[model samples]
Structure formats: structure tokens, C-alpha cells
Target: EAKEYAIYIGKMGKVGLMILLVTITSVVCQKSRDWHVGVDTVNPSGTVVHGHANIPLHRGDDGNLNANVHGSRVFGGPYNREQTVGGGLQYEHNSGLHGGLDATNMRGYGTRYSATVGGSRRLGPGTFSIDGGASRLPGSSRTEGNVWATYSVP
Candidate 1:
């Protein structure tokens, strides 16, 4: 009987905490000129998180320089979807040039910091992107630079 009472008390405590926090996260969403989005975070991903910022740059009615950011930290072990994996900074300019660089801090165990720089150019009917950056921590470092090309679908 005593053991049962203790177990019940512990269970109640956890339930009370979840109820309090869940109330504040009942809804997660974002909206844009051509898109409206919503995410139900109470389930698998745990919390619907997203970005809907207007972006900081643009070239013209048909040209654009947009930036974006997103993040999530989940719970549980096997599904331990919870670990500090990677972070990065990116840049883009009008004329179809898009580039990004990222770093994985303690990718699976601890913490880290990273940085990146990139540029892009346009070719006859096609666009090219070039990126260079590196990540470093207490005793480890990963450096990389690359160029990729792609043409429009139409």
C-alpha cells in the first residue's frame, strides 16, 4: 500500500507539469504571401516549430534575396531525437546565387561553434553556387569548400 501511494504521487507530479507546459504550446504556425502553414507538435516532433519572417533582402518584383532559420530539440532515448547536431550561417543575393555553410557542434555528445562564407553567379540560363567554411572546437576541426551548379526547370 505504501509503495503504491508513492508511485501515484510521482505520476501525478509529472502529469501536472506536462499539463502546465502543454497549455502554452497548443498551437504553432506561420504564414506567407503564397503559403499558410501549421504544425501539430503534441505528437512525434513534440512541438510545432517553424519560421515565417519576411526575410531581410530582395532585388526586385521578380528578384529576391531571402534568408531562413529553423531548429528543434526532441525528447526520449532510442528516439533520442534530442542532441545538438549542427548550426550554420548562409547568404544569398539576387540573380540566383544561393550558398550556405554549417557546423556540427558535439554533433552527438557535446557542443561546438562553426562559420561559413559563400558566393554565387548566373550563367546563360543557369545559376552556380560556391561555398567555403569551417568548424572548430576544443580539439577537432572540419574544413570544406565546394561549388555546385544547377539550371532552371523551365
Candidate 2:
């Protein structure tokens, strides 16, 4: 029941259209799994035709393809336009302190394909995270980590 689309203007100086078909599914021992699908279209002139949807799925494994966010910014455009896809899995067990590791393949003009792994923990009101990724993009291939703590005087 959700629909969304987008449009853009570039130096292409022409008209083109791209369509998208999306499907979301969950594996829960072959019972009570959820699935949904939709279509989107974009014009050749970097214009969005307007048509998008977000299929709801049950989160049991929490490690699936394209299952991170229910909504996307580029639903009507080509999948190749996406910056990152697949290879990243996340799992958080606790609220006060939780971390997730991720690996993703980068695409597009300045994106390199590489697997990345990073984790972060949140302590009270402060959170710390580290990211080390090797990709085709400039300024995006290094190992880094940080810790931040905040205190409140009541």
C-alpha cells in the first residue's frame, strides 16, 4: 500500500526510463514467512516516473539480502545505480551495548567492489564505531576505529 518514486536532471540531454522489480522474503522454517513485490519506472532524462513500494517481511534470521531497510531512495531506478549491495550482515543482541559486522560490494562510477567488516558499541548516551573499507572509490580504503563517551552532571 506504499508508493514512492523520484526524478533527476543531469547532462544526459536525452530521455530514458528504468524499471525495477522488488521482492522481499523471510525464512522461518517454512511457516509464517512474509513476502511482497512491486514495480518502478524512471525516464531516460533522469526523471522518475513515480511508482514504488515496500513489502513487509518477518525478521527472524536478521541476515538477508536487501532486508536492512524497508524503504529505499531509488526504487524506480536501475539496481546498478545503487552504491552498495549484498555482502553485509548485521546482528544486534542488546540495546545498551550492541554491535554488527558488515560486508558490502560497491558499484557506480566511483565505487570499488570489496568486503568490509566493522562493529560498534553504545554505552549509555555515548556510542563508538569503527569502519575499514577497501573499495574503488577514493578516500574509502582504510582501517579506523574510535571511542566516544559522554557524561551528564545531574
Give lDDT for model 2. 0.35
lDDT of 2 at 76: 26
Tens digits of per-residue lDDT, candidate 2, 1-154, equal: 1222223323221232222222222321133333333324445422222222222333444432222322222322354244334323344433333333443344443423343444555547766655444433434665454444443432
Question: Per-residue alpha-carbon lDDT of model 1 for 1-154, expressed as tens digits?
Answer: 2223323444354344344333323332132232122323445434322222233344465445444333333333243344333444445555444455454544355555555555556657765555555555635566433444445433
- How much is the lDDT of residue 70 in candidate 2? 26
Using all chains and alpha carbons, the TM-scores for the candidates as numbered come to 0.41, 0.31
Best by TM-score: 1
Task: Identify the runs in model 1 with alpha carbons over 4 angstroms from their true place.
Answer: 1-68, 77-81, 85-89, 95-108, 137-154
Candidate lDDT values, in order = 0.41, 0.35
Candidate 2 residue-wise lDDT at 117: 45
What clash pairs does model 2 have?
7-48, 15-44, 16-43, 16-44, 16-45, 17-44, 87-103, 112-136
Count of clashing residue pairs in every prediction: 1, 8
